[model samples]
Target: MLDFTNDSSGGEPSSQAVKQDAISDQALLDAYSNAVIDVTERVGPAVVRVETGSKTPGARERGGLGSGIVISPDGLVLTNNHVVGSSRQIRLRDNEGIVTEARVLGVDPDTDLALLRADGARELRYASLGNSKSLRRGQLVVAIGNPLGFESTVTAGVVSALGRSIRSVSGRTIEDVIQTDAALNPGNSGGALVSSAAEVIGINTAIISGAQGICFAVASNTAQFVLSEIIRHGYVRRAYIGVSGQTAPIPRRHAVAAGVDNKMGALLAQIEPDGPAARAGLLPGDVAIRLDGVDIHGVDDLIRALDRDRIDRTLEMEVLRMGRLRTIDIHPIERKPSARQGSAP
Candidate 1:
């Protein structure tokens, strides 16, 4: 009789090892599937379906569908502005399968985030916010949303990269974006990109065309900052000191005081005429020591601080000019509203 479980050597040991390997492989696959499924079920209730429309002159109302995420128990939801683009009518669908009307509370087309509030909807399921700064590459993440009108859809993948910049369909550059391989469709905008702990790290906003598994999300840090500003004021109040700068190695003189040679910081490229920096007597070649009492180590740091604050707010700046240190207070003006919002669609 031929031995079915053994090789030609007829040993019991070889067959046992092969069987164990197969079992282990199967177990790993099962675990992965279960994990994806489990996460989806837990978070899907907070994802919502949104319908947007607008009434144009001499035309019937135009509208579309997208996804949204509840960020507050009192009915605040975050979604894409384009999804709610020019829409006078906004409808929100709750987890209990009820559809109700909503209104836009605030919107920032630069980041493509819009805040919505439901009338009289006090009871809502909100997602927990996570710190996107702590996320590492290859960490597991899941996206929950409505795709192609398919409500409550979930997809999973690992974080492909961070700090990616993507231009929207309308041609605006989105900064500090999160990239992932998770499947996201049109309706996925404003959905949540959550960590294993179920904390919302990002909001699904855009995807590259004809690309498989390439999706972009707005970082939660940016989202939270924008959301808080919107909730506080009707619009984003960003401070803008009218100065464009570049990073340059610190000169020997300033390096000594900074305690580092070969250090990098803003190299004043241009100070707009009559602008805050110019009006405050900041000339070209002046090394900025600090802004608003916070150290300005580089141009990026300065930009980050200004990105979320209100325009026309006064900031104290310390600078080194002609081997002399001076302090000045300057206020930033708002960027013109005519600036293109999003990438050109």
Candidate 2:
């Protein structure tokens, strides 16, 4: 008779070790499944199926559609603008299979984000946005959306990478995009890329065709910024500053003199002529110290400070010019369509 618990000749208990390994493997798999299921259940109600069709005169009628996620209790939804594709006729279907008419409130082609309103519905379940900056590679994330017309389709994978840059169909650069290995189908656009805590960390938008598990989502931080601006202004009102800058470390003495604990500041690489900075008498070689009382830590800080509300508003800019600190109140104007935003040189 053969003893299954151990190797009889060596008595090493090989079978027991194998059994333990199998148990551990099974436990890990169970944990993964549970996490995906939890996130799906939590955000499922907010995930929506967006169906779009053209209503133009003498054009192809009712052709394109995509997924969307409700962002407000009042039935405001967020989706990819590319999904709507020149069609204002949108209809939303919630996880409960309740179909409702949706109106396009606003859309930003540059960011590929569009805002829609479900007709007269309130108290709808919405997703809580999370910080994408806190994401790390290999972190577990799940994609919940209407993939290929399958409503509430849930797929699970890890964050394959972070800080990726992808260009939208509108030729705008989308920065700080979250890349994941989750299987995304054609209709997964505008879905929720949720974290383990069931918070939306990114908005699923694009997937590499013919590639396996290569997908990209707009960062939740960017989505949050755009969503707020769209809700407030009916569009993303970006303030364009005429300077291209890179983050550089300021001298300890300079930092101390500026009363800032952060040693880094924006090093101007180029300044647009006749722009807000130039109009305010800001010259090249000036290191930004602060904008609107916010510490000048880096270029990203400056960009964050110049949101839609800052447009046409006078901001007290503190800068170190030629070793002398000076304050300039500059009024930034709304960025015109076709005006280079992101970082202008």
Candidate that would win on lDDT: 2
Off by over 4 Å in 2: 1-13, 54-61, 240-332, 337-345
- For candidate 1, lDDT tens digit of each residue in 191-307? 989887788899999888899989999999988988898888777666667777766667778667645433666667788888777888888887776777677776665665665
Best by TM-score: 1
Residue-pair clashes per candidate: 9, 1
TM-score of each: 0.71, 0.70
Ten residues in sequence with the least summed lDDT for candidate 1: 336-345
Per-residue lDDT, model 2, residue 56, is: 70
In model 2, the worst 10-residue window by lDDT is: 336-345
Candidate 2 C-alpha lDDT tens digits along 1-345: 764564466666586787999999999999989988888888999999998874679876557657998877888888998887677678888888787888987777777888888997357899889989999999999999888788889998999999998877654567889999998998999999999999999999999889988999999999998888877877777787788887888888876776667678887777788899988988888888698888878776776577677888888998887666789988888875442223342
Clashing pairs in 2: 53-62
Q: After superposition, how far is residue 117 of candidate 1 from its true place, in Å?
A: 1.1
For all predictions, the C-alpha RMSD in Å is: 5.9, 6.2
